[model samples]
Target: MAQIAVFFLFLAVIQASVALKCKVCDDTDGSCSKLRDETCPAGASDREAACLIHIYKDATTKKEMTEKKCVNRFKNTGKYDCIENPNNQQIKCYTCVEDFCNEKNSATKLGLFGIVSLVLSILVSKIL
Candidate 1:
C-alpha cells in the first residue's frame, strides 16, 4: 500500500539519522587517538551524537590530561568546570561530528599516509 511504503521510507530515514557514528576513546598516553569506524552503542540517545575531547592539566602534578567521550550537548552546556585558576589549570574542549575528529594528531596521520602513497606511486612508476 502507498501508506505502508511511506511509513517504511520514514522509518528508514529515522534509522539512518539515529545511527550516526562517532569515534570514542579515553586515553592518557594517546594510543587510542585513532578514530574508530563504528561508534554507536545499543540504545544510545541523540545527545551521544557529538564527539567531545577535553584536555586539561593536573592541578598538582601538572601532567597533561585528555578525556575523549560522547556527550549530549542538551545536558552539558560547559565542557570544563575544574578551572578554578586559569593560569594554573586551564581546560580546552573540542566538539565535532565526524569520526576521529577529536583526535589531536589526526593531521599527522594523514600526512604520513600521503607520504607513503607518494613513495608507492613512485616505485610503481619506476617498475613499469
Candidate 2:
C-alpha cells in the first residue's frame, strides 16, 4: 500500500514537470482568437517554462500589439499576473501555466485535480 502511494506521487511529479503548452501569436490588432499552441522548450539553467502574453501599446498613436508565446518562467510561482513595465511605455505582461492558458477566460487548473482524483480512486479501491 505504501509503495502504491509512492508510485502515484512519482507519476504526479512527472506529469507536473512536463512541458507547458501555450497559445502563440503576434497580432498587429487586438485580436488573439486564432493562435497557435506551442509546447515550451527547456530554458537556460534548467528553469521551468510558462505561457507569456505580452502587450505593448504605442503612447502616441495608441496602437496596440499583442504577442503570446512560451517564455522561460519568470518566477517560481505558477500564478498569473499582469504587471506593467516600469521603464517601457504602456507594456504589460501576463504569465500563466497549463495548456492554452493565455486566453481571457483561462483557469490555472492544472494537474492537481488529476493527482487528487487518482489518489482518491486508489483510496476507494483499497477500501473496497
Candidate 3:
C-alpha cells in the first residue's frame, strides 16, 4: 500500500511540472485576421474565428513547438465573422510564437532534484 501511494504521489508531482498557454503569434501583429490573410493564407479558410492551437515543449530539451492546431489568431480587430471555404470553415495551423517550458525555474529544479533523491534513497533502502 505504501509503495502504491508513493508511486501515485510521484506521478502527481511529475504531472505538476507540465504547463500550457496560448503562445502569442509573432505575425499579423498577434491578430488572427492578418494571419489568415497574410502568414498562412493558404491554410486560412475564414478570415474571422478564434483559431485554437496546441503547443508544447520538447521533452528532452524544453523547446517549444506546435504539436497540433497550429493556427493563427487575428489582432483585436473585433471581427468575429466566419469566411467561406471549399472544405470547411475551420482554421488550423496558423502563425504563433514559440512557447517555452518554465520547468527549469530554480524552485522547480530544486523540487525535482529533491524528489529524485527521495526516490533513489527509497530504492536503495529496499535493495539493501
Candidate 4:
C-alpha cells in the first residue's frame, strides 16, 4: 500500500517537471490560426518555458500584427493580463505557464485539481 502511495507521489512530481507546449505562429504569415503544435525545448528552465503573445499596431502602416511563441519570462514574475509595452504603447504582451496558455490568456486551471486528485489517490491507496 505504501509503495502504491509512493508511486502516485512520484507521478505528481513528474507532472510538474514536464515542459509546456505554447502556440507558435505569426499573423503576418497567417500561421497563428493553424492547429499545428509548436513546443519549447524539453527540460527548459522555468523562465524559458512560458508562452508569450505579442500583439501591436504598426506605426507607419497603421496595421495590427500578432505573434505567438514560447519565450523566456522575466525572473520573479507573476501572472499578468495583456499589457501595453512601456517602450512602445502599441505593443501589447501576455505571458502564461501552461500548454498553449498564451492563447487562453489565463493561469492553467489544472494545478489545484491535480494536487487534490494526487492527495486523494494516495489516501485511497493507503486505505486499501
Candidate 5:
C-alpha cells in the first residue's frame, strides 16, 4: 500500500510540472494575431520554459524581419547566436515566461534591469 501511494505521489508531481504553452509564429512584428499556440514539448529543460522572438533587419533597405519561436531562458549571461555583417544587419532576441508573451512586441516593456535602475534612482533621490 505504501509503495502504491508513493507511486501516485510521483505521478502527481509530474502532472503538476506539465509543460508550458506559448504563441508560435514568425511575423514581421512578432504578433500572434494570426498565429496559433503550441505546447512546449515534454522533457524540455527549465531554460526552454519561455517564448522567444528574434527580429532581424536588412542593412541596406532597412526592411524589418522577425521570427518567433520557443527558446530557452537566458541565464547569467546572454545565450543567443547571430550573423555578423560589415553592413548593418541587426538582430535582436527577446524572451518572456508568460503565456502568449511572444504574441506582442516586448520592446515596449520595461526589463528587469530597467526596473531595478528605476527603483535605485528613486531611493537615491529620496536619500539626497
Candidate 6:
C-alpha cells in the first residue's frame, strides 16, 4: 500500500511537471512566415501562408516531433516576407522542443488541488 501511494505521488508530480510545460503552438497570421524574409515588402511574392511545419525524426519515427517555419509568398511583388517560424529552421529563431511546455493546465490544476487539500486537512484535524 505504501508503494502504491508513493507511485501515485510520483506520477502526480510528473503529470504536474508536464502540465507546467505545455504550450499551444500558435503559427497563425503570418507569424511563422516571418522567418523566411522578415523584411520582404508587400507585392514581392505569391506563396500561400504556411503557419506550421512539422519536423519528422529519422523520416520514420513517430515518437519525435518538431516545428518548422511556414512561408507565404507575396503576390505580384515576386518577393517573400518572412515572419515567425515555429520549426526552428531559421538560425535566428530556432526553437527546441525542450523550450516549450506540454501540460501547463494539468500542472496548475494539480497545484490548486494540492493546496486546497492541505488546507482542508489541517482545518479538519484542528476541529477534531
Name the lDDT of candidate 2.
0.67
Model 4: per-residue Cα lDDT over 8-66, one tens digit each: 77777776667777777744552357534677764324445677777777555556667
Q: What is the lDDT of residue 27 in candidate 4?
A: 41
lDDT of 5 by residue, 23-120 (tens): 67734443334677887653324344666676667577786666666666544443544444657565776776555667777734323343454455
Best by lDDT: 2
- The sequence of per-residue lDDT tens digits that candidate 3 reaches over residues 1-128 is 46655765576455433322222244432232222211222224443222234334434444444322223344454242333334432333333322221111111122344456567657655665
Model 1 clash pairs are none
Collision pairs in model 4:
none
Per-candidate TM equals: 0.44, 0.63, 0.21, 0.62, 0.49, 0.23
lDDT of each structure?
A: 0.51, 0.67, 0.36, 0.64, 0.57, 0.34
Q: What local lDDT score does residue 21 receive in model 1, on the 0 to 100 scale?
A: 55
> Candidate 2 vs. truth: CA RMSD?
4.3
lDDT of 3 at 110: 29
**Each model's Cα RMSD:** 12.2, 4.3, 15.5, 4.5, 12.1, 17.1
Writing each residue's lDDT as its tens digit, candidate 2 over 48-96 gives 6778877777555666757787877645565445555454365667677
> Which parts of model 3 have CA positions greater than 4 angstroms off?
18-22, 32-128
Clash totals for all candidate models = 0, 0, 12, 0, 2, 32
For residue 55, what is the lDDT in candidate 4? 75
